[model samples]
Target: MKLLVVGATGTLGRQIVRRALDEGHEVQCLVRSFQRGAFLREWGAQLLRGNLCAPQTLPPALEGVEAVIDAATARPTDAIDQVDWDGKVNLIKAAKAAGVNRYVFISILGAEKYPDVPLMNIKHCTEKFLAESGLDYTILKPCGFLQGLIGQYAIPILEKQGIWVMNGAAPIAYMNTQDIARFAIAALDNPDTVKRSFPLAGSRAWDSNEIIRLCERLTGQDARVSRMPLGLLRTVKKILTYFQWGWNVADRLAFTEVVVGSEAIIAPMDEVYETFHIDSGEITTVEEYLGEYFSRIMKKLRELDYDREKASKKKLPF
Candidate 1:
């Protein structure tokens, strides 16, 4: 399969490209800057310089592509209308013009339910455009990523011995980005996956308390768990917004609210496993992921210390 991956430089996009390459597919990445995407050349991906916000740059990227996986997203500095909605609409038009066979889109869970939210609203609008574009499509509505949670909360626990959680004991499942890549690839050829949408999640759900307990057990490190009120987060978001430095914090807070407040966002583990023929046991759990992550950091630090000691033992050139 000859595949074109938009947002190929992004976290999930890069994972999708890697998985596609491992499967022996020819991959091309549409990137805005060649310098940032120089590594893609080494990874065997053909780079097509383009920006999602600029529709004129897409036709060349879409040419000769059999399928497209759109993983592009709006950054904190970007408005949802320009990058998320209009950008995707442009890509869809180009893909259709190029006679692309399949279009795979990565969308967040609860998009339709959160129409008032800027980002979610844009995603919902893009999904609608793809559905009516008269092209074969697959929409993946995945839950919060495990890697994201680890980056946001796990490191704080390891370094500061504490983590903040909203809505005590509220459970949320975190999906792996690699699993999402697998599903996206599967959609390219699976007849059943065409024009179908999937709500994805991890094997199990964990609340803040469970997360802290698992971290302590895995790393053998004790950390304090602080429960935060939803109202407090809302207030903080308002303050940050007033200062015009709150987009990132506001996005996180909004997502946290969804995770803590909604039961519908949780994907049924058994249903996902059975329907997709996936074994949840094979997926990386939050505890396992954190253990490996912290171990790597410790190992790197030890290597750096050893290098410093070796340098100090050498005689000075003077």
Candidate 2:
């Protein structure tokens, strides 16, 4: 069966495309740009160019597609009205119009339960719609992405301040992007996964302090992570991002709950991981994950430094 992957160029989407290809499924990748789709094309995916806002643009993209995987995202405000709510709405409508079945949607854990979080709330609304859409659908609500932590904040913090920073020592379940991709591929291949929503995470939870300690041990640097006060952290984030984004807002609230309010009992990491098969007593440990993650980050940093050196040399007025 042919599968269509939206947002094929994104961090998690790329992994999903790779896993689907490895499983011998024919893949059609929908990307916003042709250039960005080259990698997917290289991996034997039929790359289609289209924007998510227009339903007509997607039908042709979904032509001859049996299943559609929506791995796309946008800003919360934009996503709630567009991707999560309306984009999914359009995808279902288009999938039906194009006669496609088995729609696999990637979401986040705590969506239904954490409706106070704007993005999760949008996803909750979208999930409600998806359940009512009358389509063979599988919704994957993965826990916090491990890759995002490493790339979005850790490496930069390590390089600049030689540490990872956070508001409080709260243990949260996290999952590798690769594992999430593998699970999605399995769900897509197995008919049993249809009409189900699975929450995924690592086998264990690690707090910010523990994670930084692991990184310190791996990198051979006694990098120390200084805890930022919740109020101060929020102020810094607001200033740095110019109040445009708030992925950190949830963390602040969680920290406040633990500090000023009740000690929130986060679900057992094993339970969440079990749903994704990572907690079934077979998965990488935190040490192993951190080792691999740090090695990759170091390699990327080296490459970036080398590229900068070469660029600087070329620009020299000799």
Candidate 3:
């Protein structure tokens, strides 16, 4: 099938494009510029110049597109209403008019529950729009991304920076981006996935302190930890909201509310695995994922040290 992928340059979007192409499907990406998408073109996926903010740019891109995989999102710096919500609304309309067969959407876990969080609210609203758009759609709500956690916690720990662990941060089942892509592409074919939504998560849910301890053990170093009270976070978020330009910052701060809730952000995936015909054992765990990352980073650091030692020795008299 000829497929159209929105947000093709994103972490999860690129994976979907790569996997979709490997599966022998014709892939097209909707990007704002061809230059930013040069690598995507090199990957053999056709690039269509378009932006979700511009509704006029969408219909043309959806032409002859059999399936549409929308992994696009607004950044913290971007307005969620314009990009995430309105942009997706336009894309949904365009896909409907283009007579697209199937649509796959990526959403966060419990999007509707976190109405105060700007990003999550927009995502939930988009999901509702997509569901009611009279199109065949599959929504995949992911708990969290392991790749994000690495940057948020692991790298900071290595640099001896303050690890921001909240008073009562929730445990999250963080899955690898590659695995989510697998589920998204798999949904493109399975009839069972149509008009259905599934939660994609890792084998286990891990909290902040647990992850911090894991990183310390892996790198053999103590983390510079910053434990913020949940009350302080709320106060900061409230203060930021008072300013016109600080709304975006405040919105992001509200995201912590989702994690600090009564229960962890997780779901039962036994049925999901069976429906998608995926083996539970194949899922990547935090230990394996983090272990590989630390190993690679440690090797690079060791190589850098060796080069420095070699240069220093050359300057010595002996």
Residue range 1-318, candidate 1, lDDT tens digits: 999999888889998999999999999999988899888878999999998888899888888899999999977677667888889999999899989999999998878987656678788888999999999999988877888867557787668656777764357678778888888887888877788778877767877777777777765678876778888877876676665566666765665566677363577656655656777788877777777887897788789999999999999889
The parts of candidate 2 lying over 4 Å away from their true place are: 75-80, 152-154, 157-164, 224-226, 232-282, 295-318
Query: lDDT, candidate 3, residue 95?
Result: 93
Name the candidate that leads on lDDT. 3
lDDT of 3 by residue, 238-294 (tens): 999999898888877787677676588889999999999999899889999999999
TM-score of each: 0.87, 0.78, 0.95
Ranking by TM-score: 3, 1, 2
What are the root-mean-square deviations of the candidates from the true structure over C-alphas? 3.1, 5.9, 1.8
Error of 2 at 316 (Å): 23
The lowest-lDDT stretch of 10 consecutive residues in candidate 1 is 262-271
Please give the TM-score that candidate 3 achieves against the real structure: 0.95
lDDT for predicted candidate 3 compared with the true structure: 0.90
Segments in model 3 whose C-alpha atoms lie over 4 Å from true places = 315-318
